[model samples]
Every structure is written in C-alpha cells, then in structure tokens.
Target chain A: MSEHGVRIQLDRVTKQYPRQPEPAVDNVSLDIPAGELVVFVGPSGCGKTTTMKMINRLIEPTSGEITIGGENVLALEPNELRTRIGYVIQQIGLFPHMTVRDNIAVVPRLLGWDKARITRRVDELLELVGLDPSAFRDRLPKQLSGGQQQRVGVARALAADPPVMLMDEPFGATDPITRDKLQNEFLRLQKELRKTIIFVTHDFDEAVKLGDRIAVLAEQSHVAQYDTPGRILAAPANDYVEGFVGSAAAIKQLGLMHVGMLTGLAELSATSGLPTVRSRENARDALDIMLRAGTSHVVVLDEQGDPRGVIGFEDIAGLLREEVSRVGQDA
Target chain B: MSVKTLDTAYQVTPSRWSRRNLTVPIGLIAAVAVLWLWVSSLNLDSIEARVLNAEAVRRAVVDHILLAVSATLLVVAIAVPLGIMLTRRWAKPLVPVVMALANIGQAVPALGLLVLLALWFGIGFKIALIALVVTAVLPVLRNTVVGIQQVDQSLVEAARGMGMRASRILRLVELPLAVPVMLAGLRTTIVIAVGVATVATFVNAGGLGDIIVAGIKLQRTPVLITGGVLTAVIALGLDWLGGLAERLLRPKGV
Candidate 1:
C-alpha cells in the first residue's frame, strides 16, 4: 500500500532434488533489508534463480523458513501470497490474445477491482513504463516489438502495486541497446518506488550496476561472497567468487563510487566551456568526460546546472588505489 | 520541396466501385436463379406424374439442410468438451486411443456406417443424424486439442505466477487463443457434413438424395441432373458460410 518496501528473510533454506548427489541449493541464509535491492548473481544452474523463486513460493523450498514483512510465508496459500507480490521473467510473457490494457490489469482483475479502478490503474501503468496509454492500450502483444512488450511486462507486474518484486532477468532477452535503455528506465522507476526487489541475473555487471548489495553464489547455491558491490570487487572471498567476477575488477569498482562521494574535491569557477557530468553519476562517466575533453578535469555539476567541483584524472585513479592499499595493509 | 509539387503528390486516387466483396453471395444467388429457371422450363410431365415434382424438390432441399445443421450442432456440443478433457494431464494418455476411434469413424464408408446404425435404431432421421455426427466430429475434436496444447507454455506460467486460478486462466487465456484454430476445424466439419447428409435419402430420411435415387429408379435424366446440381450448390454454400463465421469470430490483431 505504501511506496516503501518490505523486508524478506530466508533462513537456512535448502532445496535437494530427488536422486541427485548434491542439493541444488545448499543450506543458505540471507537477510534482505527493507527498501533495498539485492541481486543474486551466479552461473546457470547455480541456484540463484531457485533462491529468488522460493521467495514467491513459485518453487517451494525443500526445507527453510521464509518470511516477508515479519509474516511466515510458508504458512500462507501460494496463490494468495503471489497476488501480494509482483513477478517478472526474462520471456516477457504477455498474453497474445489480450489487449495491452487487459494484460496489465490481470492482477487487479483477479483481486476483483472494479471496472473503473482497473481501467485507471492500467492506463497509469502504461504511462509509468513510458508507453502512451491511448496508443497502446488496445493493441495485442503480437503487435508490439520485443522492447515494447518488455515494458508492458513490467507494467503488468507492477499493476497491483505490490511491495515486493521478484525479477528473473527481466530485460535479458532484448538487444543490447534496448536492454541498456530498459535498465536505465527501470533504475529511475526503482528510485521512485523503492520496492524490495530480489533480482536474479547471471550477468555480474548488471548486478553491480543495479544492486545495493550483491550475493555471489557458488556451486549448490552456496554464498561465495555477500557484500556491497564495491567490497565484493575489492575483496572476493575465494577463487570461485573471483571467477564469476571475471576481469576488470578495478573498473567494476569504479561503478560503485558516485561523483558526490569524492573527498578532497577542488572547486571549478567556470560552469561552461567544459564537459559536465552530474553529481550522482559514477566515476566511469566522469572519467569518460575527462578523456573526451582531453583535459585533466571536468566540471561536476550539482542538482542545478552550476558546477560545484572538479574531478581530475588523478581523482579517479586515486579511488582504485584507495582500496588496494587498504587491502594490502589488512593482509 | 516546392508547395505545388507537394500538393500534387498528396492527391488521392479516385475510389472505384467494386462488387468483389459481394462476389460469393452474388454467385450463390445467380446459381439458384439459373437452376430454378432450368427446372421450371423442363417438360417434366412424365416425372410429375410420378413423385419428381417441384414440391418434392423443395421438401428434399429443406430436409437436406436440416439434417446437416442438426448433426453439426450435436458434434460441436460433444466433441469440444471431449477435446478439452483429452488435453489435461490425466487425460493426455488417452488421446491416441480416442483419435484412433475417431479415425475408425471416418475410415468406414458413410453408407456402411449408416446401415449399421439403421439396424440398431431402425431406419429414420435418428440413424442419419448419428451417422453424420460420427463422420464429421473428428476434425473439430482433434483441432481443439492441438490448438489448446500449442499455446505458448510461458504465457500459462506467467498467468499462474500472477495468481490466476487454473479455471480463470483456461477461460481467459487458453480458450481465446485456441478459438481461431477451433473455428477452422468447425468450418471443415460443416462442409463435410453437408456433403455426407445426401446419403441419408437412401434410408428414406428425406433429402436431395431422394430425387436422385428416384430418378435412377425411373431412368429420368432431368430429375437426376436437378438433384446433382442442388446437392453441389448446398455444399458450396455451406463452405462459404463457414468461411464467413470464421472471419467474424477471429480475435483482432492475431
């Protein structure tokens, strides 16, 4: 009902398939704080998806205690519980026969919302996902492109305004350009909605870009490293976690630092005649601007267009060494 | 670009009147008119002295249409539910067996099947109806099962994940998607039944076949030609109507 998110807890969860030597998911536990996005990242068949599905009771856990907003989830009827939670999948499975409006209205209609309320909610959702309601409401799924259908998929999942959302690679099937656009739009929406989301993706870069916290899973879904993206990139627990992180460890760490987080900042008097990046942008964008302008520093703008400070090439370089030296000292 | 050229480019093509869309109905009317004129001009005094008069032909045509229509309605009522049941998990294993039975229904000749039913029910409209139903139900039932099963599995999974009950999912998602295919099957059945209903006249159930059978008995070629032409026209007319029904029932944007 509120824009705030709810807490979800998975305590000692385990899923073992019949006749398999190893369990699909070993004894695992995680505490997801309210209003934060936690991403589960690992390889295919590593059980990251299985862990996320268990939250919605889509795939019942073999043995575990799961709770949402302090209520025991296992005791509730699955269909009833599902209605209170939003779910989206990689396939963007819109019903081909139903119009876009009806597809987005499925949950509300199931909840027995009245005709006027459902119509209003559907149009609002279409707009929320960047589709013009009047133009798209009557069109069928087959009429839309893949990217448009994915937008409709997100709209449908959020129709009833559930507090918690479970997403399994929701934009995985789109082309690179569309996927990037969708990811940016989704991030903007999440900032406004602040829903408790447990997103599962095999792409670690996506995990780093979107997650407030990232959980890297090993074989049998064992948590290899559970920490902030900056910390995980700085210090992987073991070889298994490192392998999933791949190369460019320092570059990935740059994505976690915002322009506003920089200390020892120097002021820039002139706001124009130089490339400007926003205060909320990552170190990567600032670095790109400095490189393109062929200058030592680029103006970092505040909420308004005025320049607040400047970030130099050394400033970006200093962030990488800041953690490396700290890690060295600890060792 | 110049405004004069732009104005010229925007000029619309003059619309022409077309009877193309009305061709099917117009053709049907014309065929009926020609057949009626030919029948009236015939010197059928010899035939009229017997049972091959205009009154008899009218009765035969009406009886033919009624038998075919009733048989199609009954087939739709029975076969659709049977098809849906056979698609379920518990009933899936029974599909091969049911299809084999339906194949047998079509494999045996229509007259042969009618005679077998006639022995049990005694020769009349009931036997003719049963024969027509058995001969025509297979396509609709088979297509219904295949259509429902072929719907994308992810759509159903998405529906379930969104908390739709199984019954609601079937009614809202599965049935609507399967309709176009089901209508195709229905269209096939109606056309086949119209042709097969002609055999009912041999059992004294009264159809266009009565005129043809009487003509053969009396060696009257004019009566025979009249019956053959009427039967063909009715079959073609049923096919056209079936096409119209399919177009009307189809879900838009599919």
Candidate 2:
C-alpha cells in the first residue's frame, strides 16, 4: 500500500461484539488527508471511540482495513505501531508510580533513549505543555490536580513527537475554564507540530471549535456528514445533522471557519477601529474585529484604504437593543 | 593541604542534607539503644546470667528470624505471580472463591495448622515452615491482586493502544505502580509471620518460642523475658522496614 502523506483510509470497517445482535460500527469508509485535525462527533455509544480504537488496532476491526501513512496498520506489530503514534485520553492516565519526567519519557525510554536524552526530552515536553520541569519533574501523578495531570498526559503523548495523534476527549474531563485554556493551548501546539490528528468528542461545539473537518456519526455509526465545518454548517447533508447540531449550528459554524475567508474585500471598508479589531484590514474579519474592539463607531477601508462604511455604536447596539426590546415586548 | 583539610572536615562533620535524610535512621537506632540500656539496668542475676551466656537465646532469635524470612520469601515467590494470574479477565471471576480459600487458611488456628502440617510433613522445621508459608501467603497475594486490578483502566488502554505488548505493559507499567502497595503487604506478612513463629515451638520447632516454652515448663522468668522482648523487637523491626520501603517506593505527583 504505497500511500500519500499521512492518508488514513477506513475501508468497510465494521465491529460486532460477541453475542451482540447488532454491529457496533456499520460498514463505514472514510479517507482523511494528512496533517488534518478531523473530529469524529457523535452521541454516546455511536461507535466513534470504537472507530478511533480500530485505527490503532486497540479494538480489532471485525472486517475492514485502516491505513495510516499508506501502510496497512494490520501489518505492523501492534506494540511497535502504537508506540509510533501519539494517544491522549480524557482520564489523563498518568502513571501513579512514575514522576512527570518518567511519565513523559515512557516511549522514549522504550525506544532506548539514554538517561540524558530522556531527561532532556521530558524537560522539553513539560515546558511545551506550559509546566516548569524543574518544579514538576520529580512529582508523582497523585500530587497534581486534574487539569495539571491532563496537561502532563498530553505532554507525555507528544514526547516522542509522532507524526500522528489520536485523542479521545482529551479536554473533556477538565472544568470549563481549564478546558478552554487547554483547547487554545492544544491548538497552538498543533499549529506548531502539525501532527495528523483524529480527535474524538461528543461535544459538537468542541468538534466545531477544533476540527478542520467534522465527521458526524449518527446512530448505529452511520456517517451523517463528513465535510468542512463551514459546509456542514452552511449546508447540512441531512436533517439528523441539522437536529443534532440543533439551534447552535450558526454559532458553531462561526468558529469552524476563519472570518477572513468569508468576508470579501468589499465588506472590510465599513467597520471602525474596533480597538480589538486587529491591524489586519481583512474585509471578512472586520466584523469580529469590530465586535471585540468594542469601539461603538467603526470604519471599513477600501483597497485604497479609504473609509467606505461608517458603522456606529448604535447600529451594533441597535442589534442588541432590538433583541432586548423584542424580549421586553414579548414579556 | 587545603583540599585535604576540607575532605577531612567533611568526613568529620556530616552535611545538613545527610542529617535530614538520616533522621528516621537516627530515631530508630536511639530507640534500640534505649531498650538495650534499660534491659542492662535490670540487675536480676538470673536474667543477667542467662543474657551474658546467651548462646541459647541467640540460637532461638536466629531460628525465629530464619523461619520468618523463609516463610516470607516463599510466600512472595508464590503469591505475586498467583495474584497477577487471578487479576486476568478469565481468572478474575474466581477471585472471590480464591480469596475465600486464603481466608480459610488464615482462619485456622496456627497451632492447628502446625499439627495438620506435622501429620502431613512430619515434625521439625518443615511442618512449621509449611504452616507459616500458608499463613503468610494471603496478604501478599491479596495486596498484589488489588494493586494490579486497581491500575487505572485508561492507562492500560493507552498502553495497549500504544502497542506495548501485554508482557511489557505488565513489567514496565503495572508492576512498578503496584510495588508500593505490594511492599506494604509484604511488611504486614513478615510481621505476622514473626508473631506466628512463636507458636511453632509446640511442634518441637525451635524458634524464639522454644525459649518461652522452655521457661514455662521449667518455671523460669529469665527465658520468658528474653524470648518475649526479642520477638517484640523482631516484629517492630519488620514493621519499620516495611514503612521505610513504602516511603521509598511511593512517588511524588506529576
């Protein structure tokens, strides 16, 4: 199987537990490009985890083949193959007996790194995850809080710097604030690392926030839609996705895509210094730039950098005020 | 000459770091010293005479410790693997039954077990050894099973997914994490074995119990005190060692 860059192909994958009447995963086939963050989103027990596990052969596929980097994963020794791919989980299962350094150095040690190299790698990972290695190196898993431990978990997974990462709700167990911070931190990490990633989550909002392309698995592991976050939001493939995305599809779509791409040069001329509005004069991004900038009146510049639309605090405020007035009238 | 002088000075005056680390060791040695001194202050001639020509007392203490050590080592060798086996999926279903059996072994009177073993293996160290082995197995086995079984499931899954073979996972991850608790269990077993070895004198098993039993038969206080104090010390020693192992083996947080 000579393959293109990090292409993961799932060919007719199906799984049926012993004595079960139904297949947990139906005949599903998907092709994920290299260096993409693909989110597998679904309801509980819809086989998203089963599908993810099959990629690494953790759960043997009853019938199907998973190819990573153009090599059929089934051909590689499971342990040898798994060690080469990064894995993160919601439980953040840091080894209780191993210090943070040892935990992060696990794969490196298995691959026969000398003490100095393993130590250096561990220290590097701790810093990458935003923890100071000097303070945390000798500490045990039990001493850290949930969020800190999860950070270590992510750092440990990335220690060997594998080209691919499989994450199962890595941020799901964290509290909202910590989860948000971790999400942003992980995105930053991914931007730099560019590991081909398959991230699983039940949270659609999370899928929208993080995925380049989100694959919505409906009941019985049926693929409802596998498209860019924008396509899925702007034109849902089916009603299940619409109902599944529920009323928040628009809001979620806002996150899935870059505002700069959607807005034309014609649109940027209207919004004002939205102080938070960046120095960027992108036509599409000016809206967020205007909102976050919070300076009531804004100017959008044409290609010549001349003011085109003068958006006032009242126009933005009126949008909010209209909702308020509508609620007041309804009450 | 200055470097040589610094070396000499360092040897004579221990570093503060060394002193801090040695605190527990210092306290332990002090207690032992205090006990020895207190015993020495007792000027009772019978006891003093027995303690001075203490060949008999020495033999008894040595024999008791040897038997306890033997029992604990044999128990660990047998129990650790058995515990690992019992924690597997197929074997897991039999844990309650196996635990019931271990509990029954413990519930038997040590004297009764010794008699039964004597009938089976004949009188001597062998019967006593068999009895002690049976008595010591449960703690190590139970603790090993509990420790391995309690490893977080997700960690196991992560290891499995990473392609660490079952054997490697058991060796590198499962065993290391389980060690602190297992050591605690071993400590408990060793202390219990020392206490039990005393009762083996009934079967002509010459442990510290021999001196105590001899004192009872001869109506002598000196033999009894020597045997009793030594057994107490042995139990305390094993307990202290276990505590130290637990401290050393347990890691700080991530």
TM-score of chain B of each: 0.88, 0.82
For model 1, the local distance difference test gives 0.84
Q: For candidate 1, give the lDDT of residue B249.
A: 66
What are the lDDT scores of the predictions, listed in order?
0.84, 0.75
Off by over 4 Å in 2: A1-5, A113-151, A256-259, A262-276, A279-331, B1-53, B218-226, B252-254
lDDT of 1 by residue, A203-296 (tens): 9999998999999988888998888887788888889889988998988888778988888778666646778889989898888788888887
DockQ of 1: 0.49
Tens digit of lDDT per residue, candidate 2, span A227-282? 87766666677888987787955445444333223222234443433443222333
Clashes per candidate (backbone, < 3 Å): 0, 17
User: Where is model 2 chain B poorest over a 10-residue stretch in terms of lDDT?
Assistant: B5-14
List the DockQ of the predictions in order.
0.49, 0.42
Candidate 1 per-residue C-alpha lDDT over B148-171 given as tens digits, one digit per residue, 9 for 90 to 100: 776778888788889988788788
Off by over 4 Å in 1: A1-3, A16-26, A142-145, A267-276, A324-331, B1-21, B48-51, B216-219
Give one digit per residue, the lDDT tens place, for model 2 in B74-145: 999998999889877778567778777777777788888898888877899878988998887888877788
Question: Which candidate's DockQ is highest?
Answer: 1
